[model samples]
Target: MKTVAFVPIKLNSQRLPHKNILPFGDKPLCWHVINELINVKQIDEVYVYCSDEKIINYIPKEAKFLKRNPNLDGDLVKGFDIYKSFIDTVGADIYVLAHTTSPFLKSSTISSALLKMIESNYDSAFSAKKVQTFAWFDNKPINYDLNDIPRTQDIEPIYVETSGFFMFKQDVFTKHQRRIGFNPYIQEIDEYEAVDIDTKEDYEFALKLIKTLNENGREQHV
Candidate 1:
């Protein structure tokens, strides 16, 4: 299918300043995602959405870049907004929203998600991890309490949101203006593969994980 990967990023970070440019393994964190997306044969185009001229300049000249406006560059703007703008501008058959922080996510992971969406006729799909913990809210235990019998597997599982990737049918996004449209599919990703870096700690952890994978000879190349 004609799929375009739109990766939204910004130089003005809150928790970890310029975390996208930070070194991870041998290259910048953004390179990992870029390489994977670019290598994926199913993807038609790879677009890096950002406003920072310096960041945009640093991106590989080989890959296509879409310079975001200053209004879309601010921290207040939600990721969905940036994604919607790209859809409106490009109008691809399939739009994949990927995060630069998720360097560990393989091209296969992305391709599989999109394939599922296409095969099932899903409006949109996003990566997530199945959660089965004793959730709590307002200092009160939710889902299961001490009084209830412990049947962890039987409990209704919650899909923990992983901002790794999202696949949307271009027309659905144009009509709905949201990633999670009416008919959404949640692709369950492995806990180990769901690495989202929003802080310095998250960044360090991801690097360590990548290093460990490399040390174990499990590192993959695009």
Candidate 2:
């Protein structure tokens, strides 16, 4: 099956302006996702879907730029629409839905997730961070018994919203009309790997983390 790694980027960010183009370490944040997709052997192609000319120019030569449709570029339309638009337009057998904001994702992680999904015959798979906490809201327990909050280790593990990446079967998506379908699997990742850049604070934190890694000469995977 032909697999295309799709990244939907936008110039206007509500929390942080021009966030997609923001620098992280030696390259822009978006480059992290692009690089990972490029390195993944399963993905035959990489598409950078966006309306911004700056972002378009920033994309590497290996990636194909999918000019965003004007209708789906509005602020009111959800980001899911953009993903759907690309999936419909490209018509690939497999689609890897990725975000430019997540710079810590490793190419190996994405490859492993894709292999796992394919081998298991999963319709779709998304990354998450495992949480083992008795979350509460308004002094009431949300995901666990009220008494379980104190005994945190005993609580059942839950997958938190990581939003790192997704591996989708295009055939199932056209029928389901969403990234996730009837058969969905969760790929658990570390908390740091799930960091998404949404605000100035988020950008700063990511930059600091990247800088620390660079200074330590740690093996960079993303």
C-alpha lDDT of all candidate models, in order: 0.79, 0.81
Taking the tens digit of each residue's C-alpha lDDT, what string does model 2 give over 1-222?
788889888877778988888777777778888988898998899999887667766667788888887677677998777887887688788789999888898888889888877788788889999988766669876677654355667777778757689888886777777787778888888867888888999998888887787789888753
TM-score of 1: 0.88
Give one digit per residue, the lDDT tens place, for model 1 in 81-142. Answer: 88778777875888888888777788888878777787886889888998887777799777
Worst 10 residues of 1 by lDDT: 53-62
**Which segments of model 1 are wrong by more than 4 Å?**
56-62, 138-142, 145-147, 220-222
Query: Cα lDDT for residue 146, model 1?
Result: 72
Model 2 TM-score (2 dp): 0.91
Residue 77 of model 1: what lDDT?
Answer: 84
What is the lDDT, from 0 to 100, of the residue 109 in candidate 1?
81
* Candidate 2, residue 216: how far the Cα is off, in Å: 3.6
